[model samples]
Target: MPEKNVPTSPPTCPTDLSLIDSTYPVGVPLTATYRLGFAFKTINLRLPVILTKIIDQLSRDKNEIGESCGQEARDDVKIVVGALAKFKNEMVTNKPIYKTGCKIWDSYLEHIAQLYFEGVVEDVKWYFAPWLHVECYFYKRIHDAFQLSNHLKSFDPFRKQKEDGFECSKKSSAQLAEYVLSSDSSDAVLQTLLEVGLWGNRCDLSLSSGEEVSQLGNLVDQLQGLRNFVLCDESANFWKILKDAKTANPDNPLTVGYVLDNAGFELFTDFCLADKLMDRVDRIDFYVKTTPWFISDALKTDFDWLIERMCSGDCSDFPVLVKLAERWKGYVLSKRWTVVESEFWTYPHAYFEMQDADPELYSTLTKHTHLIFKGDLNYRKLIGDVSWKPDTPFKDALRGFCPAPLLSLRTLKADCIAGLRAGLAEEIESKSQDWLVSGEYGIMQHAQ
Candidate 1:
């Protein structure tokens, strides 16, 4: 078991959300006029366009796919293409989520059935469902389309974009890699690395409508410019947790775990940080998305692909990257670094719901010194995607979901937030009309 170094921060301002009131920015019934509404609409509509592009490319290059998987993959390609088009059309037309016998089908269906049993007439409608449920079902439905196919059960439509996104950020990766190795005080370097890890979140494909945005200019120098933008700064607390882990395990290095977010560039940045963490910890356990979820989320395959890319790809000009790649191979060989996949992550449920929904996963979470949740969706899950008043305490919103002392490193790409000081959210809103979705601001909150 990991030694506890939990912070003792009181709830910022305890605000109860259990009371029911159907209205926008306060409580239930998130409507079409809000940014959440528009963001969901844009993502749902944009995915089909992406799926078609993948299908077309696959159809044109069936021979290429066959060279690796087998000729039967051509038929699987056709199955996947047809299924993706059908799924896209269903969402575009507001068709009810269909049953596909997935593991979550019973729970999801029962939720809607119960909603209908109660008097919620718009029980299963896409826009009418809980924003979290709607979003969760959308990605699962996409995965189902591929899963029901023959040879393409594991095929990832978003794989190309993820790979391309990483390729595009090579310059940023190299700069951060070099900076990490530069001789500097341990505290300053750790602080810089944490901020770089935070900013790496700005490039999420889900927020950018499937586009790639690389980190720009000198990452270390850019930290001061981003300082004021971080609504909640807990980088120091996180470092303390890491240091405490080292203290606890004086004879052996502690293990750190990451509930990973986006793949490609963001994951490369995570690796840059993980590479540093490895020097102190016995290992780092990366919990990746079980499937190609939310488009650019890291899958087990993505982790494997990145290792291969670093080891064999022609981008050999980066000495830091190459050195890390070689070190990563040895770490893998020595069984010091490990990867895990859990369907619970890809499930539509919130973090608070995890202990009940998947106790096995929640039980596994307890082994880590700390679990670091990356990116916006995980943040949304942490807070249950509730419309809590801007100053609601982070732990208060957590609703007792803390499995271990944890940290959330997220850029504010969505409206749901908690743990800000009084008036901070309003102040941010007054200064910038769209602070939440602009990716200009961030949060590095810690909770015990």
Candidate 2:
């Protein structure tokens, strides 16, 4: 287990917690505008109930594990669930959410209130619903605790800033020449490269003038060399497998599935991958959450207010353009990919159990489909988002789960690193303490 970096300061309460507690709960039923306030209250109350179910399951399974497993899992869940129950009770009783550093707590609570008033309660709730609200809600509470105690010095789980200086430096002129001369399939490669580049550019953390267009141009140039290696005799073997699958089962369409993440650029990347797979396969099915609170760009569902705002020229800045491109990409991809929205992924059940419960969903997912899970949150879900050691093997971490030919493409945005090569963790530790959580490095893993 990872050691907790606790602070040695007394706890304090935020001044605005009272304001937030009173106004938020009352506003739920009294608001005359949108029903968002009521939605937020409903979701918040439901969180504790969901968490109670998870806690019950953990207790039942504790006796079946080893001494260490039983002790650790039970202890961790007890502390976490206990903290959640205390927090919820405090809220119900109109107590301050934070004991110290009240200003920051107030600011965050105000932000939550504004988001609710602005009709983003559904997005906020869905984002927190995973793992019965244990992960995100715990993080939010931790943030509040640290801020109140003035313990920012000790809390360093997330990197202070995104690592943004990486550039592809090498060139393969000879390979590029051979690829151009030998293949009639260059167009597919070029198009795939364009889509990935555009998606990356649009979603980039840093904003720029014509960033998407500029990145698209540079990506086309950079990928030409990479494409050559991927298309070589030895590498083309994989393509042959895909081709054979397509040829032998013409009646059974090849399905490409995307387990989605955040909206905008992230969704664009899913589209790029979907388009590439669609070029080779017969069909594509994109899965999304079915609840109003669970909808995201990944589902290609409409956010009517946001679309209307954009259309009314409310968002005209370069950064806004990048966001607009993200929504537009989803709109464009929905035309080709068969979109399936479900509540299973949002539930607390294990993947195989979810599959067992919904055989049709699993059958559709497992048959002829190459599943692509995107971003940090999805990666967490894929691995159960536990506190595995940094050097744990990917296969070991994923022991209980298997869902088609899967590839997890993610920039490291949180704790819980695994599948490291020998000495890779040591090398990273020697150079930077924050490397694992920095979102600097990425992974391309295929667990079949």
Candidate 3:
């Protein structure tokens, strides 16, 4: 969304992913080795553009950033901007990744060296490394830029883009708010809202590399047409899981956990679903990133900012929006909703690594009756970002990471996928070349 202010036009990744004759064997980590692959485009083009936008924002907002932080704001902005500019060059030239030397990153670097570099991290370059490790490292390095500054240690370069994205979706958000608040809790109604939230994943800015995107028109009314685009649906299974949990627990209150994804409209839809979910669960724990991530990923600050904006902003025309916002505000105030920040969420490891890497967080997650993970990046992480066979069962792809019954509401923005019917991926690929990474398709897959 930074108005072509970067040095070059952003390069586009191909949406198509050929089903058979894969360049890598099944279960291999995805990398940019496939020249036409999304990872290739992302590393070469999209990532640099994202960095350029940050540099532009910092340069443009120096005074304002200075005013908010301290007298050192301008100098802090310049420092981060220069760092980011250098980082962008590193990415574009496919330079070897270096240690930020931050305690957390250094520890994770050891892990990465073991997995991909065989203890020699100097061998890990930007392009050929596992897409997940390098992409995550990309953001971590960006955070390190600000982290080194005296006044900008806590700055978030993508905050305004996330807020602007929400503003763009306000009308559609009000519509969904009214619809959900007024609807009954029937299974059919819940299914509709679930689909709405699933489609909301399409609005992710990180997929667009910081470009603006949002929901449009009445969200619910468009669902009938969007149905076929859902590659797999387990909404009925999701509802049954909730029902069974409540029934089996009887005297106990069911607790749900949300491993949230992007901010803006997708996050707004997440709140709408959570509002409905409260009827079946006693408490909902919302997991958030401890720092800025993947450009648009939810942070505790993003969550708080949304709620404040909803409550205090002019919503007189959509009274129900504010009404629901107030209820959500109270949920946090009264402890019905809890926001959790953990370094584990930002670590450059797959979900399967959780048990050994962060057992305490894994154990805490085990206490939940169900966990809902949102968006494409979480889906990629859940499956280890491996190139599995098209028809691989979702549970099998999980590599034993199940801490509780979980559902992933994801729109396909990456080439990797699991839990498709035999021949389904081939069938879809035959019809549309862009079927894999277009964000035009989605899945609501559940696993225990």
Candidate 4:
């Protein structure tokens, strides 16, 4: 890698830099940075909180975690603690980054240069960098710390939280499972499950600073009350797209793919929704995180674990859950429901970069009838983490990243939004000041 000197101040832009609040260029630093601003709090507080928690976990002895995986565990605990302490210090001091041993670290260096050349920020310091870039970078560094460990190479610091959260959600899970098992293919059931799945996103752990969140309320009853919170409901169109494909070829079922998000209750709701859609679609592909990420992002282990938990007891204890699990297991065994992991999902690249950066992955996605992107981070990447006008056409904002018809099931957790009616944002603003950052609103946005 070529060396470049860090400037004493931010560099001037050589290329056009967007300033519109709705569509501000993501890489560029906002002027008059506030001490308590979202970016500042995220870097100074949230990131450190997660890092400190990681260090705490690593510092734990094998006896503390309730397992003695033997000397391998002890050696790894020592190595992991040392690495996390170093990484945590770097974050607290806003130290200049050292290249992590990740393969993409070199590419990240190239991006730093690209950001400088485009006059984005002074350097890639955590506090000054783009939220999408810095947040993803932080998680990658966490992965690296574990990767450097021998016995703990595949250890997930977040695994216990994932399992515990699901355990907490079993009541909700059983209720939904019972509903799905006894329910017929009524459109009401479909819509109810769809809305239930959307609200499940509110239980994200990353947004709550790594805390375990569960779904407690009656999901079916709450759907009507939560109706107004849906800012854009192209849900009918989402079902129509699937319905049309099924109508076209009753013999050949449509292929559906989900770029899934957080685990626990959310994944359970997603499974419930998928169970209902199984009759309409031949196969449902779940694209899970290859690595533990964003505190609670779902992984292959999460998927497998959830199934095993549901199927563990005899059908008498929780008959509906066991029945649903048995059906899901059957699907997995027959290759009708497949779980896919792509390292590409872990990369920081925006959706638009998919065609140029990972065409094979892009081509693979094209096979799906609809590629459903779930939750906020995926939504941010889909829209390039920009400040596009609230009403920017979803298709236009996508900038030709559509390999297949896409539906984004996202709760508003960031300032960026697109595809709203002309006056809807103002109306929302009139009612609530921080509606955009709050998880109170969501959208089921569809674009081909």
Candidate 5:
């Protein structure tokens, strides 16, 4: 099939280089720079054909097709990578000029560029959609910096807060257990987990401690309504599956695998969900990225360091706090009775490439697994990160790609949401131009 179409016009580059040069200081906050960088990155990485569609749509003053929008957004990403690659080539002859961060960024850019040049873009586009691409870039940049700086890792802002959040949940899990036992409905556990999930999103560690605490409380309060909204057919089916699993093997532990996203409050929320699961099941395991200090939440596997930081009460250096919050949202939704780790995130290859680079992780995922892919990042991976029709069924969107049972629980943090009912796409368009791409709405799908 042809790649999804997108707009084609070249994005207007900022004339002032000073805008890019402005540094964010410790106290004075400026999110605009990052947002601009994100936009630029998005426009650069889009496929050329998709870019043409976007230009066509924009020229005609029509809404861009799903694929076109994705391509246009990613086009800037391509430019950024290209520029960095050029910078890297220049560095071979002109050393002592580029900063360590830039150098690392260049290396990652080169890797991505190679992927694009090798005609792997189509296969990997699903995995490297703009948001996921940005995330991967962020991690690689940090990894490169650490390598250059005597292997010194940076502090993640979310790590300490997430540890504290987990501890708090541990203390409250008994209370949650009491509530679960008192309420006879299976939805009780799901409801509590939903509240915990929302809290995870709000209690973002990137923000100040005070802000994080306040958001946590707010999310906790909103659980009752979210619970009511979740009483659909899927909810009923989920409970049925759980019941059958319990009946078949009373001694068998229910495994809840968390495809983790970001660190901090989200991580804390994930811990809370895990604690709650222990009330219903037998064991819990978590999977996280194996990289150094990249995205905050991916560092959850490094629990030892997180615990120490929480004890010392120092968490200020971690960047990408908002992304961490988004990932936490995914983490909260995946909890069940027992949790197990999935090593896919930590592996270097894409999901399709996993069979060769990390067959063990792939094999483990295919066996006795029900994956909860969290956030837009995982969604990109699940759907090959390519643009698809808005009305595509979730399973069809995956195109028979996934090997095991899986569900995508994502708040539309980025463009490229799929698996909508026929009119659902129209409804979103009529109500708000940004609805499909906005993070306000969510999707929950199961792949058998």
Candidate 6:
């Protein structure tokens, strides 16, 4: 369980995120230079709080962790805590971000220089570097602190938070499972599951800085109520694509790839979608992070944990969970559902760069008929974390990344976005100026 007393509330800041001015060119990477922007607030406020929580979680779980991993792990816990404290200080103090001399990261810096900067850049600071790179680095360094340890090298500081998040959402998960299990393979059911998976992006722990969050009530029942909030509804297009693919390849095996996001209710929603998709698609491939990332990204362990709990735990109140879990287990055992991990996912590179950065993973992705990318971070990478015009076409914003026909089901949580119709962004801003950074609104954007 997570340390209940650890305070992870975000510090109060300006609610009107649009008030922050951006001086970068239209296609430049999002940096924290804009004082009032979400990137800046994330660096100066949210990330440090997240780091503090990691430190606090370590301290609280000291005894249990030690017992599990042995005495060396206990001593290493103090060391990791101290390292995290120093890391928090570095971020809070606006210290320069240094390159890890590792080949992969250093090459990425070179890639950034060749692509974004004109090559003479040197110092990368917490408050001024590219938001995506620095943010990923922050997590990488946290893992580094443990990777250097003896007994705690495999320890996931974020495990408890991920577990607690799932526990909190079991009610909604069971409800969603039952809804899917009882429903027919209708377009309505598919659309409902897609929206549920989209809204599930809102439960991200990184967005909340590790605060407990849950999916509550009847999620399927709430779909219509939240329909208007979908800024871009490409579901009709999505359905057409699915229909075309199924009709054209009736004999050939059809596969779908899910570049997964948060691990709890969001992951549960992902499973619901995958379960629904299995009726049409032959195989499902789930790509998870190799390490604990951005607080709640699913690791292979988290993927297994949820399934194991559902399969073995007392589900008297929600037997459908066990039924669904057993079915999913059979799918896994039969290789109908495969869990995949790649170092490419943890890298800071954008999706467009995948061909050059990790060709094998890119080749693997091409075999899938369509890729469903979930959450804000994946959306950011899809567009290279650049600030495109609000009305920019999603494909144009992709900058030529077409691994497969892809759909990004993302709740707006950052300043960067694309594929809004003319004047749509402004009209939404008139209602809620903070809509860009707020998770209230969403987009089901498609790109081919």
| TM-score per candidate | 0.88, 0.48, 0.94, 0.89, 0.58, 0.93
Residues 191-225 of candidate 6: C-alpha lDDT, one tens digit per residue: 88999899988888887788887777888888887
How would you order the candidates by lDDT, starting with the best? 3, 6, 4, 1, 5, 2
Candidate 6 TM-score to native = 0.93
* Model 6 alpha-carbon drift over 4 Å, by segment: 1-25, 113-121
Rate residue 334 of model 4 by lDDT: 90
Relative to the true structure, candidate 1 reaches a TM of 0.88
What is the alpha-carbon lDDT of model 3 when measured against the actual structure? 0.85
TM-score, model 2 to reference: 0.48
Stretch of 10 with least lDDT, candidate 6? 1-10
- lDDT, candidate 3, 1-448, per-residue tens: 1121212465533334322323556778888866657777677677877888788888888989878887787787878888888888777666778888777667777777787778887877776688998899999899989977988888888898899888888899999998988898877777888888899888878877887887779889999989989889876777888888778878888988999999988899899988888878899999999999998899999999889888875666778788999999999998999999998888888999899889999999999989999998899999999999979999999999999999999989888998999999999999988788788898999998
Worst 10 residues of 1 by lDDT: 1-10
Query: Residue by residue across 86-140, what tens digits does model 2's lDDT show?
Result: 6656533333224223443344344444545353333333312222233333335
lDDT of each: 0.74, 0.42, 0.85, 0.77, 0.44, 0.84
**Candidate 4 lDDT, tens digit per residue, 1-448?**
0011211222222123222224335334322123434555566567777777778866764555436466777667777778888988887667545566565655755676476536333455655556677778789888888887777777888988778777777777788887888898778888888888888887777776776677775677677878889999888888888888878878876888989998887888888888888877889999998988998899999999888888886335777888899998998899888999998888877889888777998999998988889999899889877667788898888878999998898877777788999999999999998788668898999998
Q: What are the per-residue Cα lDDT tens digits for candidate 5 across 1-448? A: 0011233445333433223433222222112233332233343333222223223333343223214445443343333334434433332222222223454344434455465536333322212223344444434443443343221234232344445544443323333333433444355666466445533443322212112232323354455554432211233444466568889988886765667665644554555555445555544446666664222445545444433443342322222222333333444355432234444564333355556646787777775435556555666667655446666777776766566666555555445645676777666667766554334455566666
Rank list by TM-score = 3, 6, 4, 1, 5, 2
Candidate 5 lDDT at 129 equals 25
Candidate 3, residue 374: CA error in Å?
0.5
| Residue pairs with backbone atoms closer than 3 Å in model 2 (clashes) | 12-99, 12-100, 13-98, 13-99, 13-100, 14-98, 100-148
